[model samples]
Target: MTNATAERPLHSVSVAGIVVREDGRVLVIQRADNGAWEPPGGILERNERPEEGVRREVAEETGVTVEVERLTGVYKNLTLGVIALVFRCRPVGGEERLSDESTDVRWLTPEEVEQSMKEVFSVRVADALDAAAPHVRSHDGERLIAAA
Candidate 1:
């Protein structure tokens, strides 16, 4: 086997992202655990793919079905010990549903997301908005915020 494949160490595959609408609204979910607003997402389980993680998280948190369009960016937060993948997706279908993980879900405009400086966010959101280009991996979630 190639060294790359042989040396493929275990990784935490997680997925999450900014859900957007044709009206320029971005989906943000208020985390029930911390009351912080963020794009809906969660970690991928064993044998699970990042795409599945994003789809499952979005559905669980927002009751919205989403189709991941493209990989916007990848991030690793040293402070939180988390590695996350962020994608650009559109709402496919579902009622606005809330869960223990998310207290609320809303489609906010860019201005609204900026005003939401109440919490640190992923910059991948901004990058996704600015360009569909995929970003390299990061070691900090704070870097994800700058993507905005």
Candidate 2:
């Protein structure tokens, strides 16, 4: 490998699940680390597939088992170099409970999601809810900065 290639910064990939129930409520968690309300997810392990990572993260944070439907959005945190793959999923089993990573877990309506979450996170849920093709967006960790 070239010296330049070895010296380049590395980016981390994360997987998130926008778990939706039949009544249209979307699942969310209040992070224990920062108390921010967002979808349940975390850094993907190198050995796991994106879908598997999503299921594992959601279950770990929210105690909810999900059936991944499809990827709904790709979000990049420009400042952190973290690429998040967000998926639309259905809750197949399990119950809502908080873990060490999350302080609270709840199923919220789309409006509640917009009201409670930051723009970067709310957009992920909104995109998953929409029937259009998956969205590609970038954010500065708080607000959206670009779209494709």
Candidate 3:
């Protein structure tokens, strides 16, 4: 058997966008499979750039066109080896519509998100809303943990 050190490690890179509207509302989606409401995002494709992947994922999941403003956070799912880059964006065009990935989409205020979403997910949106500095956080897919 190959030694662990010799085996190549695998990790998936993902991107998420927080699309804020003019009226101080953020766009979120209820995933079809799990009903969890979070920002629109997905794993980056092998041939795609980070910005392009984020834009495509948002459009596919929420049917909204966004102009990426700036990166707002970085998160890692430690158990899954998934690294996520979160960005702040503005809705440039398109309307909210259901897609294969998302079952529901809606605009929510910061208070609504804090009450509805889990801490890990809420932190992503919160970071975007604050727009102070980029947050780097780690999680076990559900709960955020203190970085080691």
Q: Considering every candidate listed, which one attains the maximal TM-score?
A: 2
Residue lDDT tens for model 1, 36-138? 8788888888778788888988998899998888888777776676777888998889988889898888888887887763423646567678775787555
lDDT of 2 by residue, 100-128 (tens): 99999998999999999999999999999
Lowest lDDT sum, 10 consecutive residues, model 3, at: 1-10
Candidate 1: residue 92 Cα off by (Å): 1.2
Best by lDDT: 2
What local lDDT score does residue 135 receive in model 1, on the 0 to 100 scale? 70
Per-residue C-alpha lDDT of model 3 across residues 20-95, encoded as one tens digit per residue: 9999999999999999999999999999988898899999998899999999999999999999999999999998
How many residue pairs collide in each prediction? Answer: 6, 0, 0
Error of model 1, residue 116, in angstroms: 1.1
lDDT, candidate 1, equals 0.77
Clashing pairs in 3: none
* Candidate 3 accuracy as TM-score: 0.93
TM-score of every candidate: 0.81, 0.96, 0.93
- TM-score attained by model 1: 0.81
Worst 10 residues of 1 by lDDT: 139-148
